[model samples]
Target: MTSTARAAHPFITSHGLKAALADGEEIAVLDVRETGVYTHRHILFAASAPLWRLELLIDRLVPRRGTRIVLVDADETLAHQAAAKLVRLGWNQVSVLAGGTDAWAAEGFEIFSGTNVPSKAFGEIIEHRKHTPWIDADELQERVARGDKLVVVDSRTPEEFAQFSLPFAHSLPGAELVYRIQEIAPDPETLVVVNCAGRTRSIVGAQTLIDAGIPNRVVSLKDGTMAWLLAGRALAHGRHAALPEPGPATLATARDRAEVVARRAGVRLIDADELARFEAEAGERSLYRFDVRTEQEYVAGHLEGWRWVPGGQLVQATDEYVATRRSRIVLADWDGVRALTTAAWLAQLGGHEVFVHAPPALAPRVTGAEPVRVLPSRAAAPLVSPLQADALLNAGQAVAFDVDRRAAYERHHVAGARFAVPDRLQSFTAELPPTQTVLLVSPDGVLARIVAAELAARTHRDVRAIAGGTGAWAAAGLPTASGAEGVLTGDDDHWYSPYAHADHAARDAGFRAYLAWELGLVAQLEREGEVGIRLIPAA
Candidate 1:
């Protein structure tokens, strides 16, 4: 269908969408609102794609332009806007929820709060079905104090582990648990504990080891680091204790174990010819090609068109990467362990057809980061260099606004620039003096440019974008400001994790609410009866 044709009949009723979801068709339901607004209430399976960043993230979130996409917003206004943008970006099968999420609620459908709902709920379901073993923070602390011969492995990304982690915890992100356990805990009699910030990764990580038939006794740290902090334990900050790569002997053993697990889980092993066939069917079906390796390894070399997402993170947050339900996924890695182990969990997660690329050799032709495909700005706005923007701001000739994520804005932005949510930019700028030229800034300037062009057309005022955004300003030795000064929208752009809260009371309350939400997911799934997860027994 053409873009214009889609625009004419671009709405699906809530009832129709619910039927479609249950019918097992390949579809991606996106909630086109900022993170904060999305976290308040959204459809159970919808991915978050704020209107402002639609073009920037559409390719990564939904690779196949022809995949059926249904967008939701508070009342369909923003969904309409996002739909128009997606059509321009070559997506044909796009529609908005007729009355938005409100309409869904009116129809007595389930509405979920929080990000990565599907993945977190799946984690809870896994623990319930598999009966994954776990140890609480208090008991683990006592064991540590008593000098128990056990190893603690953190299943979060290295960056998260470095921020704060439990005592004696070594970083071995989720996907790596099965592949590196032989080296991390060499003794068969030793105990192994896995943890993450919250529950999902920890449970998934521990289970991966058990399913692989590792010799050591493996258990997830119940409630993870959140429970530790709640139990009045201090996390070690700025720790860089990531484990070393497994030796060749260990890697071979891990590969053999992972192969058995993958076979038992029914994860398909594909070759070059099969992958080519999958690529050819991309127009008709959604296909995701992921190099399931560490970021450093991916940057060093990878398949030309494949994207990099660490194996552990991929299993923990599948919805974030694969937006289309029932799509085909291909995981690639040189070592058999990472790709095979990741595919094992994904296969058990159900919905999608999971496969591992069993390449003859690990050689890759491409180098550096995956290239990002961003839609061209609708119109080019006048641009000013960082130095020019600095002078203009200092001389009161132009008023500046930062359009980056709230967390990035709070970290450090161009001095004197007020933070503005892109969707609310026009209203925020209306309060400014008519004669002052508006300057917009973003992390990399792509979003700033896009917003500038739209704002210029709407407001008909002199609007311009900082050429390279705040990063450029800092690079030029210009002054910058930090903290939440001059924030117009105020914490309404992104959802804050409990750890993000500064107030001790609020943080504790947030954690309690979050844990309760996770714990209640299995019950919710039982009531709903359409989550589509299938638990496969380990061999």
Candidate 2:
């Protein structure tokens, strides 16, 4: 348990919470449970903040100290623990939901069950209001077979696009399509098809192009690649077709068109000086500065202190980005198109004060920040080299515990090693072999140390991290084994995405369930009264 004292925080009953919602107060109700548990059932508008990750995520979730926060759990333990942590982190107006989610259910209030519910619901809402046009897989396949002049744009992350997509689909992920479409499809008469692994991105991407008044006849690939697979079509895997850089003429046109759409959506523009002033006051208000650009572009160069969130995914998963309800957001991009277009949609869709920040000259190109290896300032666990670990394993003196995702561990892990989910290690340690020395390994050394520290505290055994983690081990020509040999806990922190499921039956079921959940959100939003989304009709 955290050593922080439980502060004098009020516990609001479900009835009181309902009243607060009805009264239009600025509040964020968070369910402090694992993603799997939260996805099964959680209060509507309650974002997931799993207890294990509460500390790492709380800053992003409740950035504002004064925002009214209500923590909910199946039991009061997680809620109380989370509240104590939040209070220790200097969050004010923190409270716990009395009697937890059960109390909310007992009060006859809604309890939604699903992952990415807000984004999925919003996509459905957009489709219902705008009636986004789409083409079925058979029609698209026939058109392609006939040598039709068209382009298929895949609106998923680069990694996801690489996994699987339509054969002809170019990796023009989400917001990038706004700026890159002109270069990819210069001919207005050409048919442009947008697709994702599933429906949401395709629907939103196609509609965005239409709304921006792109001359092409843009349409969504109905039900996306999942539908294609269901229709007995095979998707291409490991594809790398991507859009080229926009020329001067194409870039100019994109900026012009995007500005018009931004104006229509009432996206606010902030100059550098104004943004500086706004950022200076971050202590008093929650302000998220994001570079709404592709990861490659962001990696090549971006302004300081700005994180990259591809515009489309940011809007699609706003809750994942901004957890503090009603926080201000400032979006930046090299060209005005992507950021402005994203800001416009986010303004209406997120109900947040959104702004577009156009740097004078791309904010002076600099290498992006390195990925942080989260570790305590002072870590006591000794770091062991891969060679040392190998000798220890050969001698049967130490057991290696891989603290990584189950999928990663199954892909390639140290031979004869066991998998351990760091959060549940205490409950899982008993399953490990009887060894005094425990070797903790992660994809990188940073996470291994944290888990190593935790294991050290719990077992009172010699806990050491594999120096440089699996990467170093692999780099040293160490042999690895594939498949889940010894998994301590099920991979439940992330809800399974329908588009990525390998099993056809499971994928189909996920799609059906996702669509059903989405269809119900409009009524829920109306009753729950806090989504704050206003559907702007396409002109």
Candidate 3:
């Protein structure tokens, strides 16, 4: 945790806090308490902004540098830490009151108590400036049914829309609204409404759109879908957009599109018999099931095999995802639509034996509609699999690649592995063990297949996908890995026959450590236009 560079005020009792509140000053009363504790009670007028994203809120949303930023926390440690983060961002006028809110309450000052409504009020304040209003479930339902020509802007993130939506709604997350607005809802005449599990994104998104001077009418679907369900209004959880796979360019230099493609590609398309047999049997070949969706959505619900990897990030860091690197792939989501798109992209990259998971839900995400046209998969598309991958795995033959997200690769992988995602399959061409057999692995067969196809496109060579994901191997009673979470790379490994561990720490410690490190855990999905350097493995 960093320190606030500005002059910090001495600890003030509750009296001072109350005095400050009554001063009519534009002091931001911040709640630095844990999320659970803060939600139960906080000082009146104080905002409950978690420290994990103090920088996220200050740097991105709160624009004015001189805005008097105050840090308040149930604990002093958090407030001080937050203060430093703000100061580092060059906010000169920042300060944290010593003793924090607990000290204030101890001094007999009034503390605000309630759920996280202040932030909502804050969003409302921003929206009200643009004359934005709130719409109840009935009104929304009526309007949508009447074809009110309103643009139902589901301000909840895309997965939220995919999970559940109102009529005529297009998902535009709060953060992406300003940037993705043109792509999702361009017509100014169309009305837009924001929503979320509750009020946060809805309120924020609606306000943001209005503040941008959008000629369209913008409002929050007040109370969101929860309110809709309670109000007896119909809910329309519809089909989500088919996020495409990352292209060759995107997979390597910009893993953005590539990750999305891999995540959304769903499971490696397996033969029905093979899938059934694998379920009936268990062995360890390092298998993993990745449900390619936003992490938040994955937390809500998902298939058993899926490890959450947002497609965009997968394209960027597949090589680090240890599970995908060594395991056979099975990709899934609310339905197969996204998985198919991801699969296609992976096929181009050359990992064959791809399979798309078929969600049993009738209206998977949007309409639970079944696809009308079933195209032959990439396995059958313009490429063929190698009879065996041993030739590539042999030393000095071909590149032995772990083709998945870098994060997944780093956690657990083949004993001796080389990092490379499908799109960046060629980024390490010079480093590869020349035309030996190029053995590829991924939880999503599509990416592996895509890499193989791309390699073949250049050399007409064959490649192999792990028959079952690494997870499947373990389920089949094969060897598996286990360890405590801290210092993961230092943990023990259960060996696999076909693959080997790379001399990462010994030879490439700096590079591996660089990619393995992150500013935060539970990372947010990378929005478009994010440019920066990273330490993830090859491609």
Stretches of candidate 3 off by over 4 Å are 1-11, 15-33, 44-110, 113-118, 127-130, 182-189, 234-239, 242-539
Error of 2 at 455 (Å): 4.1
Model 3 TM-score, all chains together: 0.35
Supply candidate 3's per-residue lDDT for 366. Answer: 30
Taking all chains together, each candidate's TM-score versus the true structure is: 0.96, 0.90, 0.35
Measured with C-alpha atoms, the lDDT of residue 239 in candidate 1 is 90
The sequence of per-residue lDDT tens digits that candidate 1 reaches over residues 1-539 is 22345455467888888888888789999989887889889988888888888778889889998999999998977898888788888898998898899999998887788877778888998899899999999899899999999999999999999889986899998888877788779999899999999999999989889988898899999999999988877889999864678999998899899999888888888889999999999988899999988888889888889999998878777877888988999998588889999998888878789999865674547899999887753677899999999889889999999997888999999988889789999888898899999999998898898888878988999999999888999999999999988898876787788998888788889999999999998887776567778777744
In model 1, what lDDT does residue 12 have? Answer: 87
TM-score attained by model 1: 0.96
Give the winner by lDDT: 1
Highest TM-score against the true fold, candidate: 1
* Model 2, position 323: C-alpha lDDT score: 70
RMSD of 1: 2.1
Order of candidate numbers by lDDT, starting with the best: 1, 2, 3
Clashes of each: 1, 0, 103
